[model samples]
Target: MRLQIGPNIDNGRVRLDFRKSPDRPQSTPSYEIEQTKADEFVKKYNSQEKKLFNMTMIFVAAFSMLGWITSIYKRSILWGILGIPGGVIAGLGVGAMISSNKKNNLMDKYNVKEVTKN
Candidate 1:
């Protein structure tokens, strides 16, 4: 059996194709995988979330390091407290990301309809 998955294009739509089985002459139908607004949202949301998360984490780490260094030089712990909020935000972002990612993959979201070959 041959299987092909088309690229996701035009806002998360995919085309699916399958070759007939040999031992049995059963043929799988061809169909287009369409997306709902929810699908579009999920795709866009995941990507944006990743980008924002990374950007936020980078600044957080940088500030945290700066705070640590400043605290050490000044012989005071208060300066290092600046980095604590960044650490907390990073932890919360990680948790939110995990939940947002638990959705069906492309294959699971689609179905097949038989096409008559010319």
Candidate 2:
């Protein structure tokens, strides 16, 4: 028996053919592995949430400190304290809005489709 080896471009799989045909037919199993679209989408969504949360926290702290600087410059500590709640509210609102929109977009894009029977 001679060994023949060549590439088959028709199918992505490498072909392994024998020089002599087998007396009995052979059955091979095939597998279909799915892509990582679902996992990737989830990971991306989580990453976005984490990043946004961290950024929001940092900005809130910075804005509050800015109030202290303003008070020092103007010689009034009470004004600095008054700016705290406003900074926090603005930070929280903006952060929540951004995270919510990103999460919603991801869910809409990667949500599994369902079939209903009437």
Candidate 3:
């Protein structure tokens, strides 16, 4: 198993490559298996991420709306002003943490290593 971090214009991009033997010119059957597994894993991971993103957006909107309504009801502009940043920060932070942990766990399960360049 090998993980390659792209260079130059693709910096910070991690790509998975499967090879049975570096010296061999042809790929082995196991390479196909690894590739398929990786493909499926990527598809599942992306789907879950999309769902998480949508949920986070919803949460942020709801929180912001609630804050705005509360501020109006109480006749204070502070709450309304705070809602936008508060919602965005909280929503994105929690989403990022969850996504990171989930990615790490999935990588371990799939025997994949994440490599960083520089």
| Model 2, global lDDT | 0.52
Which ranges of candidate 1 are over 4 A from the true structure? 1-36, 77-118
Give the TM-score comparing model 2 with the true structure, all chains together.
0.49
Top TM-score: which candidate number?
3
Q: lDDT per model, in order?
A: 0.50, 0.52, 0.56
All candidates: TM-score: 0.34, 0.49, 0.57
Winning model by lDDT? 3
Per-residue lDDT for 69 in model 1? 66
Residue-wise lDDT of candidate 3 within 1-118, one digit each (tens)? 3222222223233355333456644532121114435566666655676776777777677766766677778776787788667767776776677777886787677665444322
lDDT of 1 by residue, 1-118 (tens): 3345544556466554543455434445444455443345334434555665665566567656665666677775665665456555655565456533532233344343334331
Q: Could you tell me the C-alpha RMSD of candidate 2 in Å?
A: 19.1
Full-model lDDT, candidate 1: 0.50
Off by over 4 Å in 3: 1-36
In the range 4-49, model 2's lDDT, one tens digit per residue, is 2223323342222224456523542221111334345434654675
lDDT of 2 at 108: 66
